[model samples]
Target: MRHVVAAVAGLIFALGLGISGMTDPGKVIGFLDVGGAWEPALAFVMGGAVVVYALAYRLIVRRPRPVVEVKFSLPTAKKVTTSLVVGSALFGIGWGLGGYCPGPALTSVVSGSWEVGLFVVTMLAGMGLHQVWERLSARGSAAAAPAPAAPLAEGPLKGVDA
Candidate 1:
């Protein structure tokens, strides 16, 4: 049942992207251009999404738990870290350069454009690289951490019966 709901939600989102012309690299690039023949239509789509999410977030938080989950799995991080900054920058750069962020790229795949296919493939490869990097970083941090000191030895006869 949860899976069905998720599929339906994804279908609706993809349809929205397609209907809003977000699946087109040219359209997305036009929006990003900003200086030359900027396309402002997507702004409305984005603004509508923000408004909908704001309302949904408020309503959803009032519920003790989600309909399909035991509890909400929202982000708990409050501090900005280097990894977050770098990841966000990379995502923005990729979106600006390819004019296709992950969602739109996946939706555009059905169009059978080689460029989109290439972008998806590259995106997947980048995800894999990120995983590897994170694992290696975790290992390095663990290795650098100091091991717990050995428990101090009790005085002689400490274990012997009095």
Candidate 2:
């Protein structure tokens, strides 16, 4: 039931992207291109989305639990670190370069565009690389962690240094 709802929601979102011209790279790039033939349609779309989300969140978040989920898992982290800043910058740069953010790019995949395929592949690769980096970081931190003191010997060897 949850899967069905999620699938339906995703389909609706994709349809919205397509209908709003978000799935078009040219339109997105044009929107980004300030001081040129800059488009304002996406800006209006985003503003409308934000307003809707704000209203929906204000109402929905008051509920004790979600309809499908046990509870809402909101982000706990509040501190902004260097990694966060760098990752955001990278994401923005990638979006500007490719003229397609993750949502739109994923939605555009069904269009059979080779550029979209390449973008998806590289995006997946970047995600995989981040996973590898995270694993290595975890291992390194584990290795660097100090070990606990060993317990004393029992019985006859309790007093013995060796």
Candidate 3:
């Protein structure tokens, strides 16, 4: 049931991308061009998405758990770290250079363009490299961790053994 629903939702999303000309590199690049041959059409699509997400996020964050999850696993990180800044810059550079971020890149794949294929391949490689780097970094940090302390003495179940 979930798979079917997911497929339907993905189809709808892909259709939206196609209809909005997101699958076309020209359209995307035009939007980014700004001072030169700028197209503001995609901005409306993005604006609509932002509005929808803002409303949905406001409602969802109030809930203790999501309908399909045991608990909310939201990001707890609050600080703007170096990795975040570098990753964001890379993302923006890729989007500007290729005119196809991940979503549009995947949607554009059906067109059988070799350039898009190459972009997706490199994107996957970049993700894999990041995963490897993260694991290595974590291992180095975890190696320096002190021995585990005793379990919590105070919480929702204070003094209660689990």
Candidate 4:
């Protein structure tokens, strides 16, 4: 049931992206271009999306649990950490360079665009690399962690009350 809901939601989202021209790399690039022939149409689309999301979020969060899920999945982190900053920066850079973020890129895959296909491939590779890097870092941190102190050999207190 959850899977069906997820699939339906994804289908709707993909249709929205396609209908809004968000799946077009050229349109995205044009929107990102601030100096030369900047296209502002996407801005309106984004603003509308934000407004809808804000309202929907408020309404949905008022419920104790989501319609499909037992609990609403929300971000618990409040402080802006270095990882967040770095990840956001990287995402911005990738979006600017490739002119296609993950959502639109995935939606556009059916269009049979080589650029979109390449972007998806590289994005997957980057995700895999990140997983490998995190695993290696976790192992390194675990190895660097201090070991627990060994107990002292049986002392006089062992045979006598303190």
lDDT of all predictions, in order shown? 0.80, 0.79, 0.78, 0.79
Separately for all candidates shown, the number of backbone clashes (residues 3 or more apart, or on different chains) is 0, 0, 0, 0
* Runs of candidate 3 exceeding 4 Å displacement: 143-162
Instruction: Compute each candidate's TM-score over C-alphas.
Output: 0.86, 0.84, 0.78, 0.85
Instruction: Provide C-alpha RMSD values for all models, in order.
Output: 12.1, 12.0, 7.4, 12.2
Q: Could you tell me the C-alpha RMSD of candidate 2 in Å?
A: 12.0
Candidate 3 C-alpha lDDT tens digits along 29-102: 99999989889889998888899989999999899886666786665545666766888899899899999988
Candidate that scores best on TM-score: 1
The lowest-lDDT stretch of 10 consecutive residues in candidate 4 is 148-157
Candidate that beats the other on lDDT, 1 or 4, i.e. the better one? 1
Report the number of the highest-lDDT candidate: 1
Model 2: runs farther than 4 Å from truth? Answer: 146-162
Per-residue CA lDDT of model 1 for 1-162, tens digit only, reads 889998999999999999988998889999998989998888998999999999999998999999988987775545666756887899888898989988899998988999999999999999899767766755665577644221112222221221
TM-score of 4: 0.85
Please provide the root mean square deviation of candidate 1 (C-alpha atoms, Å).
Answer: 12.1
Candidate 1: list runs displaced more than 4 Å.
147-162
Give a tens-digit lDDT track for model 4, residues 7-104.
Answer: 99999989988889888888999999999999989988789899999999999899999887899767554566576679879999999888898899
List the candidate numbers ranked by TM-score, top first.
1, 4, 2, 3
